[model samples]
Target: MTASSVPSSSASPARIPRRKPRAARIGLFGVGYHVYWGQFPGLLDELLAKLAVLERRVAATGATVVNFGMVD
Candidate 1:
């Protein structure tokens, strides 16, 4: 059986520690550009707006905003 076919409670899973990148700044972006969601300009606008706020929020937490990744 494939992994997805296994019963949820039947197996012990390995937990990997999520090591955060040591870069001074990181920008997270959605997959809208590569998908049909980017067809509408409004979609990109909204994405940029949200990313801008997110960058500020992350920067407030001490991490720098290298780029919001919203290129239009």
Candidate 2:
């Protein structure tokens, strides 16, 4: 017990307070193949506009999006 008396507030180390992360239930799906949309005539509106821009970028990150569009 001799390393400069060992008494610097127990060498300072104790801080745990972090818990705020639980909002993600994303389930987007896109499978276009509806008989080739009459030989590629706008291909089913471009695959439903790219699945609505990937469901608006995954519902802007505060997720809970369930887009099951173009499921052919």
Candidate 3:
């Protein structure tokens, strides 16, 4: 059989199936000693600053970061 004899269905332009949209929800939390804040002096601020940087980096990767910082 020649190429012309082939059925058109094999080469037909059927609508391509589309995939559904993907969604992801992520929660990011940090922990530290709340009681030590007074004794440590600036410990709370240090830990929070670090957590903020981490959250920013993670968010940059397209992930939704729910910051639950300073868990007492």
Candidate 4:
């Protein structure tokens, strides 16, 4: 089939990129984080940092992140 046959530019099979995986909501609070017994302060910081990086990667693909589940 010729290109003209396609009705719209977005008609291409691969025109749009696939969505990214939803950010894992660690806690039910919706802050995108959580805590565990015996967990140290440093560990939480690491986790938050990782979450931030994950958010950036997903955003780069032109997709919406699911949510930021956290607890107070």
TM-score of each: 0.46, 0.39, 0.65, 0.41
Give the best candidate by TM-score.
Answer: 3
Give Cα distance to truth, residue 16, candidate 2, Å: 15
Error of 4 at 58 (Å): 0.6
lDDT of 4 by residue, 7-48 (tens): 886555755655975554332122423455245657666666
* Model 1, runs deviating above 4 Å: 1-24, 34-41
Ranking of models by TM-score: 3, 1, 4, 2
* Per-residue C-alpha lDDT of model 2 across residues 8-65, encoded as one tens digit per residue: 8756688676697667898888887778888889988888898999899889877989
Identify the runs in model 3 with alpha carbons over 4 angstroms from their true place: 1-19
On the 0 to 100 scale, the lDDT of residue 25 in model 2 is: 90
Write the residue-wise lDDT of candidate 1 on 16-62 in tens digits. Answer: 87697555667676446546455665776677788878878888877
Better model by lDDT: candidate 1 vs candidate 4: 1
Note the Cα lDDT for every prediction shown.
Answer: 0.70, 0.84, 0.82, 0.56
Model 1 lDDT, full chain set: 0.70
- 1 against 2, candidate with superior lDDT: 2
Clashes of each: 0, 0, 0, 8
Q: Please write out the lDDT profile of model 3 over residues 1-72, one tens digit for every residue.
A: 998988887586877676965455568777877789899998888888998999899888777889888886
Better of 1 and 4 by TM-score: 1
